[model samples]
Target: MSIQPGEKLVFGAPSTLSDRLTHYCPGCHHGIGTRLVAEVLEEFGCIKETIGVASVGCSVFTYNYIVADWVEAAHGRACATATGVKRARPDRMVFTYQGDGDLAAIGFNESVQAANRGEHITVIFVNNTIYGMTGGQMAPTSLIGQKTTTSPRGRNPKKEGAPLRMAELLAPLDGVAFSARCAMDSVAHVNAAKRAIRKAFDVQRQNLGFGFVELLSGCPTNLHMDPLSANRRVREEMIPYFPLGVFKDVTANEKAGA
Candidate 1:
């Protein structure tokens, strides 16, 4: 439909995303995270030159939602796979969409190693605390005292350890050009998330070191909460532990090789 005179277009689906609806569970923030990536890709006008790696998890089918060249990596191996893709096609914008279990639990080594090596790729990590797929088990990033199938009585710091703060963990790496954490619970946070995502992609385009963005998301199904409650939990609970901000940014530095 043509826009009438005096009418302004405000919102529409990003062309980088597929026309098909996402398969994420109700209240899940994976859809929002994926869309934000697509929007940034569209804004960069690099969708045609982009290559996405989808790992095994709730976001395993990210290829179906994001309209771009894609490779499906094994559980917890997205970072390793993405490293190869970026090395093979230095001209293409490379990124990986991964979840807490895949990125922090199973693929922790790969995630850290890739960052330490400073591979020119962007990583979008969705931290929902619990594993949304494969029966709502506890993940490495599950909050303290948080209940999950594996931790029925709630996580015990003495035995289970605290949630892995990936952004903070990766920020200090010499190879990491950018590292940031953002929440998806409110309009303001979502806008901040978009900005973070844009910066993550920008680093790759500039051939900087590794770019990492951790998104604090919600898994309503696993959390046994409605959409609203899940969002509130992210705002009130997750955000406190995993603070949102650019933990490390090379652009912010002035001294050379400091």
Candidate 2:
């Protein structure tokens, strides 16, 4: 236990993740977010029983990285796929990893109905604001004045409407057991994201209701910024719009006797 040269390592990649080299760009937050999910799975001892539903977009290739049983769902059908998986295999731990465009724009209905029905599952919504794949197009969650390939002139709320707040939108649903928005812009925020991810799964474990966590991640490759700058953008620009913290938690309310 000494600080000697011939000693054990302090940390290593979580067993829940594959050794495959990530294809994500430098400073991209997907890698960090994926690791957080894998760590949660390992800590919960549910890796062996976990079934991940990967949606189309940059996140579609998540099956290549996470070391778990995964199924590829069409562009925005991840939530429906996860719902079916959970229903068919009630003993398995089911979750979906989705991007902003995939979950908010195209798969919006599925995401809504899943939460509205209080499906016993977890949904990890990664909101980077821009569509990372398909050449960095503007996404439904793209903030006003945020430039993108599709919105080179910056998103105009008058034309496209304001950014969609999925966490805030889903938090009030009657079937939702947990809902929160988190950012991975700093160490403190990363820790908070981990707690939210764990609680989402814990909600499923308790057979309460639908659990959802929307993570405001950074996309340097898509945002046309360096890794560090992308992180700063998340903190400075994204946080004010999306905000971070739990929007709802039935368990917390019950514990507080609310």
Candidate 3:
């Protein structure tokens, strides 16, 4: 593979990201999501001043893939940990990468409280619907009729209640400066997801308020489907239910004024 004299390289790994191989299973979107994060941090020239909080679950290894100062938080305590990190060192950019189980489940309260307090932090939530690391258990964001180890018969709204839409739920909070949802199913959606992630970080960098971005990802192993099939599920089923777009963005008004 030789490059022509005038041919240019349009894509390559970011300096802020590790060059090692990822441990995530084939067809998992964790790698893509983390790559986007590293790219955004690099583009903003804040990788050195960035501090990351990683919670329990598949996302716990985020520090391994991205080069940054990182702290491992207890299960469902990433938001709490990130808040502490940000308050103690306001100069550093702080963020948390969490899975649905770690965020929407036991850690929902902590996340909400942090956002409601207007903590200057960013949250990157990966919602694959099912718990990926813990043997595919039903997570708080699992869709209706979705089958999992915990819900062998499929999720029932009456018994389990409805899936929690974190982006929509948190967007209405006064402390939240930005809240958005994006999917990882197609090239266009992935680009959109990257933009959403960048905006979430921008909101934090401005010292505005809490920022949150929910990425609808695919877990082929947990979903018991091939890579292509799992991606289709995200595009077809997940997107329809969750919907992809910004639910709230305070920066819009600022930009409008400018």
Candidate 4:
């Protein structure tokens, strides 16, 4: 079905599944990112051939939203599950949806190792800086001085260290084919996020190995701010640290010499 501006399309109808109504908080980017993935799967005609691994955090509902074959991984094992799925079903597109805490923290080893091994899978990481599902704890991507339940007095760099730049860290990995960091705070940034998701899927379709997109999403409920203010915080506080751009694009490199 066609979607108009300001129109909220529930997960069903011509989309994919009918059971998965979005449970994300208002202004949370998980819904947008999930919808973009669903749309990309539909566009690529890979709905039946797609397998998604859902991780812990707010994104655990990904299986309910996306109609494709899906499985739930442990708190930080989505990447490992995605790797297994891709290996077993090489013809199918495999991807994992995870959050900052799930990916960059508890799952950091799994993610980095998967990328280092060049696993043929796509990873969509939602970096909201705070742990939303677990009561707004400070995530590994939480900015310096950012306040959270775990860091009520604000994050101290000496204690917690700076937020991890995941995309940049993975850019030099030979196994990584495409890596980008995007935001969903503004209209332009949202569109860019969609493009980044699409590109990661495209790389997977081409069997180009590991592809990752770190999306700077907003967590209004955890941030204890209204939707507008939460978005503004992303622009003012988060973007400076995470930034928004294509950090690595191996697809262009392959085409340049062709």
On lDDT, the candidate that comes out on top is: 3
TM-score of each: 0.95, 0.97, 0.96, 0.93
Q: Can you write out model 1's per-residue Cα lDDT over 49-129, one digit (the tens) per residue?
A: 999999999998889988899999999999999999999899999999999999999999999999999999999999999
Ranking by TM-score: 2, 3, 1, 4
The local lDDT score (0 to 100) that residue 191 gets in candidate 3 is 99
Give the Cα lDDT of each candidate: 0.93, 0.93, 0.94, 0.89
**Best TM-score among the predictions, by candidate number:** 2
Tens digits of per-residue lDDT for model 2 on 1-258?
236777787788888888888888898888888999999999999888999999998777789888889988889999999999999998999999999999999999999999999999999999999998888999999999999999999999999999999999999999999999999989999999999999999999999999999999999988889999999999899999998989999999999996
Q: Which of 1 and 4 is the better model by TM-score? A: 1
Clashes of each: 0, 0, 0, 0
- Minimal lDDT window, size 10, model 2: 1-10
Pairs with steric clashes in candidate 3: none
For every candidate, C-alpha RMSD to the true structure in Å:
1.9, 2.2, 1.9, 3.4
Per-residue alpha-carbon lDDT of candidate 4 for residues 1-258, written as tens digits (9 for 90 to 100): 578999987754435554556899988988878877887887788888889999999999988889989889999999999888988889999999999999999999999999999999999999999899989999999889888999989999999898999999998999999999998888898888888888998988888879999988889999999999988988998888887888888988878979
* Model 1, residue 63: C-alpha shift (Å): 0.5
Candidate 1's TM-score: 0.95
Kindly indicate the candidate among 1 and 3 with the higher lDDT. Answer: 3
